[model samples]
Target: MRPVLIAGGGLAGHACALRLIEAGFEVELFELRPFFGGRACSYRLPGYGGSEIDNGQHVLLACCTALLDFYRRLGVEHWIRFHDSYYFLEPGGRLSELRPRKWAGPAALMAGFLALPIFDFRDKWAIVRGLAAVRRQAGDHRLDALSMEQWLERHAQPPRAVERFWRLILLSAANEELDRLSAYHGVRLIWLAFYGAPGAYRLGIPQVPLGSFFAEALWNRYGRLRRHVGQPVDKVLINGGRFHGFEVDRRVVEGSAGVLAVPYHRLAGLVPQLEADFSEWSCSPITNVHLWFDRPVTELPFAALLGRTIQWFFAERGGSYLKVVISASRQWRTWNREQIIQHTLEELKEYLPAVGSTTVAQAHVVKELCATFSPMPNLEARRPGPVTAIPGLFLGGDWTATGWVATMEGAVRSGYQAAEAVIRWLRADRGG
Candidate 1:
C-alpha cells in the first residue's frame, strides 16, 4: 500500500498523520512552513534579545479531551499547568476569585458564581436563569438559528451581566462578538466547560513554547511516518472521481488516500473542483501585545480584565513580561502598533497599579487578522464532514463539523474523524 498523504502540517494534519501511523499505515506529511504548528505557534522575536513568544496567548480548558489525549500521546502532558481558580480584575484593582469547591461536586461552579462580588444580586439572578435555560435547551437545533446575543436578551440578561460576564468569556473562547456568534456554539461551550463534568473548567497553560509540542524528535518512534517541511501542495489530482495524488514543487506525490487539512480560506485555490460555497464565511481577528517591563507588575499568573479594551493578560518571565490579548478586535485592526501598545499599557495600569511605576523595556504586537472563522448563526450546517464526493479523499480542519467552536480540541477531533474515515475506506477496499 502507498503512504497516506496529509497536506498542511497544522494540528489537524499532524493529528491525522499520528493516528494513521498508529493504525499501521505509512503516512507522509507536507507543510508549507518549516514549523509544524499553524496558528498555534511560537517564534523568536527579532528584537529584544530574541525572546521566544507565542503569536497569541492560547489556553485550554479541561473540557478539551481530544487535545489532552494528544498531549498524553506525545508524552508532554506534564508540560501543561492547570489552574483551578480564575482571577478576574475590575477597575481600581478590585480582585475576585472564582474557584470551584471540590466538596460542592457538580454544584461547585454555581456556588462560585453566586459568591462573586463583581455582579449584583440582579445580575447573578439573571445569569442563573440563563444557565438554567442553557441546561434545559441542550441539543436544541433552534439555537443554531439564533445569535448568542439574541439568546441572552431573550433570557433577560442585564447589561452588567452581559458585559462583564458573558461577553468577556465567550469572546475570548469563540473569538467573535456575542451578536455574531451562534447560540449553539456558545451554549455548548458553557455546558462543556462549566456544567458537563467535574473539574472540567480548570484552565491549562503550556509551560513550553507551542512549537515544542511537535518537535521533530517526537516523531522518531513512528518509523513509518515521514515529514516534508517547507513544501507546499500546489494541487490535488483527481481521476475517475477519486483522489489520485498531489502536485508539489512541480512533481506528483501519489498516495492510497489523502487528507486535505488546510484552512477553509485556502481550500479554493488548492482544489477548486470541489466548488464548496464559502460566500457566507467570514473571519475574526485577535491582537496580542507583548510588553517587557523593568519590574514585576502583578503576582497573578493570568487575569481577566473587566471593563477594558484588553480582555486578558498572561504573565511571563516572573511577571516582568506580559501578553495582553484582545479578542474580536475588529476595531483595533485599523490602529497602528503604537496606539495598541499605549492603550494596553493604560488599561494595565488601571488593573495593576505597579504597571504605572514600571518602565516598559520593550514592546511587540501581533495581529492575527484571520485568527478564526466567525461562528455565525446557521454556519454549523455549512461545515463539511470528513467524507467528500471524491473517493479516497478526506477533509480535516477545525472549520469542519466538529460540534465545537474553532479551537485546538476541535482541530484534533476533525483529524481523528478523517483518519477513521480513511481507515474504513482502506479496509473496505481490501475486503477486510
Candidate 2:
C-alpha cells in the first residue's frame, strides 16, 4: 500500500496521522516548521524569565467534545483542569459569576440564564426570545446573510446588555464580535454551549505547557510514525488532475493521499489553484499579554474583564500569569511590545487591586496576526470542505467547513474527517 502523506504538522495533520496510522496505513507527516502545534504551539519567552508561553491564550469550553476526546485518547486528560462556572471581573473591580443550576430540561436553561449577573431583567428575557427565534429558523440560507448584531437589533435586544454580556460570550466562542460575525455561527455557538451538557458552561485550561502536553500525550500514542520536522512543503506537484506528491526544498516525496492542514493564507501559495478563493477568506488576529506577578493576584482560575483594556485574565499554577486576549485584534497588531504590555498591565491592576503595588517579575506579549479565519457574514459560503476537486487530496484546517471557528476542536474534527475520507478511498482502491 502506498503511504499517506500528511502535510503541515499542526493539530489537523497530527490528528490525521494518528487516525490513519490506527487504520493500518503508513503515514508520513511533513511539517514546515522545526516544531509542531502550529498556531497552538508554545515556546520559552526570551526576556520574560524563560517561562514557557503559548502563542496566545486558548480556552476550551465544556462543549468541546472532540477536543476533550482528543485529550482522553492522547492520555493527557489529567493535564487540564475545568472550571464549573465563569467569573467576570469588571473594570471597577467588581466580580460576577455565572453558574448553572441542577434542574432538568428547560428549567436548567432558564436557571442558567437567570444566574448570569451581567444582563438586566429585560435583557434576560430577550435572550430567551432570541434563542427561540434561532430554534425556529430551519434553513441555513435564512442565517447566511445576517450578522448576529443585526439579528439582535432586529429582535429589539438592548445594546448595552449585548455589548457587556452577549458580545463577551460571542467573542470567546466565535473569535469575532456580533457585529461582524454570522448570525448562524453565533446562534449555534450559544446553543451548543447552553444546551449540550449539564455543566456546559465549564472552562478548561492547561496545567502544563502545551508542547509538553502534546509531546507526552499525542506523540507517545503515535510513536512508530516517522515524524519529520523543519521540512516545510514548498509546493504540491499535481499531475493528471490528481495528487502526485509534494516538494520540500531539493527533496521530493510521493504519496497517493495527502492532507493539507496548514493555515488558510498559506494554502493559496502552497497550491496556486486555490489562490483565487483564498484571498477572499480573511482572518482575525488574537493578542495575548503574559505577565508574571510576584504573587497570586486572584484565586479564580480565569476571569473575564469588562469595560477595561483587558478582556480576560487567567492565573496559571506556575505563577500569576495574566493573559489578555484581544479577539479581532487587527489594529492591536501594529502596537509595539512595550505599549501593549503597559496597557494590559494597567488594566490588570484595575481588575485585581493587588497587582497595583506588586512588581511585575516579567512581561511578554505574543500575537497571532492570523489567529483565526474571520467568521463574518457569508463565511459559510467561503468555507470549503475537506475533500477538494483533486483526487486523493484533502484539506483539513480549522478554516475548512467545520461549522466551527478556528478552534482546537475544529482542527481535530477536520483532521479526523480528512483521515476518514483518505482511509475510505484507500480501502476502495485496494478492494478494486
Question: Which prediction has the highest lDDT against the true structure?
Answer: 1
Instruction: For candidate 2, report its TM-score.
Output: 0.94
Best by TM-score: 1
Global Cα lDDT for candidate 1: 0.91
Clashes in each model (backbone N, CA, C under 3 Å)? 0, 1
Which regions of candidate 2 deviate over 4 angstroms?
104-110, 138-141, 216-224, 274-276
User: Please, what is the TM-score per model?
Assistant: 0.99, 0.94
- Residue range 177-287, candidate 2, lDDT tens digits: 788888888877777776666676678888777777557445756644767789888888798888888887877889878788888878777788655376556778888
In order, what lDDT does every prediction score? Answer: 0.91, 0.79
- Candidate 1: misplaced stretches above 4 Å? none
